[model samples]
Target: LREERIDTVVNFAAESHNSLAVVDPTRFFRTNVLGTQTLLEASRAAGVTRFHHVSTCEVYGDLALDTDEVFTEESPYRPRTPYNASKAGADHAVRAYFETFGLPITITNCSNNYGPYQFPEKVLPLFTTNALDDEPLPMYASTQNKREWLHVLDHCSAIDLVLRKGVEGETYNVGSGIEATIEEIADLVLELTEKPQSLKTIVPDRPGHDRRYLLDATKIRDELAWEPSHGWRDGLAETVAWYTANRGWWEPLKKRAPVSEETAWR
Candidate 1:
């Protein structure tokens, strides 16, 4: 704690909920951008090298659009929400540290993260917890929001690659082979929850909701051989089973608060 025993620093901490950002843009910017800077300043003061900046694909925004291309490390940043814009700013900050100060760092922009221990705020767990509790599942916008999904374990593994084997001053995209729409995700959750028949609730949409997000992981794959072992369907099933079996973990969360109607949809 005193002399920088923390040789490697990982910066995966950020306010990442897209819908939440729409409701409170100022909070999103303050936490995601300013928080990252605060960490970087601390790491710089501590003389830490081997920093890993874990980021998301929403920085690219709207991959389902006819004009939107799959996001690479070099793609132009066109973030839709305050959440993503903040991350984009943080990404630039890391790059600056790498170039000017020569900090040993790797930036990994990854696909949608899913797996165990994920809070119910995210899409997979959110719908799962809500539907399993027999609460109506609130969907935002069109069921067509597409995202490339990666299991949390796989995502952590990819971060390890960036930490250990990834090249310094380079950015890599990490992704699973599967992609799905929001509606399809809801249907899957319903099937897993055993058709309660009354738990489906589709709302209008979130304001400025990104239509699709896709990450191209060729760099991570070709460079570090980071391939995914879980499919969207398989991972969804496994995740559903975990939440179902471990009501002890999620019940408190559902009981603690109701879903925010303000951030529910557009």
Candidate 2:
């Protein structure tokens, strides 16, 4: 950064698979926690004025499906998985730099992202591609596990807003306020791809799977005036089409991903 005269830094690097994290937590810690601390130190050393750390809502842990409660910026951290625990540690480290070293830092914890160019490991692209090829769609422990879906483009927009206009030493929740069950998402993918519902298969769930995750993006909305612009249905349709039309982009990734029957559904 010193040699390049970098003024700002956006940290989005992480080992983000919950299943993989459970099997191998060391990599997650090395990348998400240590990597963040290293980057913060480097930014401070280089005198970077602004640091934006992109996070996930998983750090807030699971919410009861029966409740209306959503994760707010002020929510207490209760990470259940190795992936979320690593990210939560990183979030705290970023704040530590702000408080101790007076570094200008902002963090944005976003919801589930689905869009073009996403790796086939994630649910949306995974199911879409699987259905397109007449492969079984693996459902994790419970199809009832819920998540708030946000298009990647909208997530990017929210990050941009927090990076540019957000206050230092603050955390913002970024979400579309759209929630759906895993089973529902898989069904939708099958419907969109014209595949039979029988293609759905229940697979072993990852360890410590969260029952539900919902985000209250009120802070980013009220303070930064940022909200998701894409409609969920339209965005999902376009995402499925992108995978359908550009199999080459994701096919190679899936090949290298080594999806086993146990973890295929994630």
Instruction: Note the Cα lDDT for every prediction shown.
Output: 0.81, 0.91
Model 1: number of backbone collisions: 2
List the pairs of residues colliding in candidate 2: none
Question: Compared with the true structure, what per-residue lDDT tens digits does model 2 show for residues 40-158?
Answer: 99999999999999999999988998998888988999999889999999999999999999999999999999999998888898899999999999998688989999999999998
TM-score of 1: 0.93
- Per-residue alpha-carbon lDDT of model 1 for 45-136, expressed as tens digits? 77886888998787876676554467777788988778889899999888888888888888888888888878887888988988877777
User: How many angstroms is residue 257 displaced in model 2 relative to the true structure, after the best TM-score fit?
Assistant: 4.1
Query: Each model's RMSD to truth, in Å?
Result: 2.0, 1.7
| Candidate 2 local lDDT, residue 5 | 95
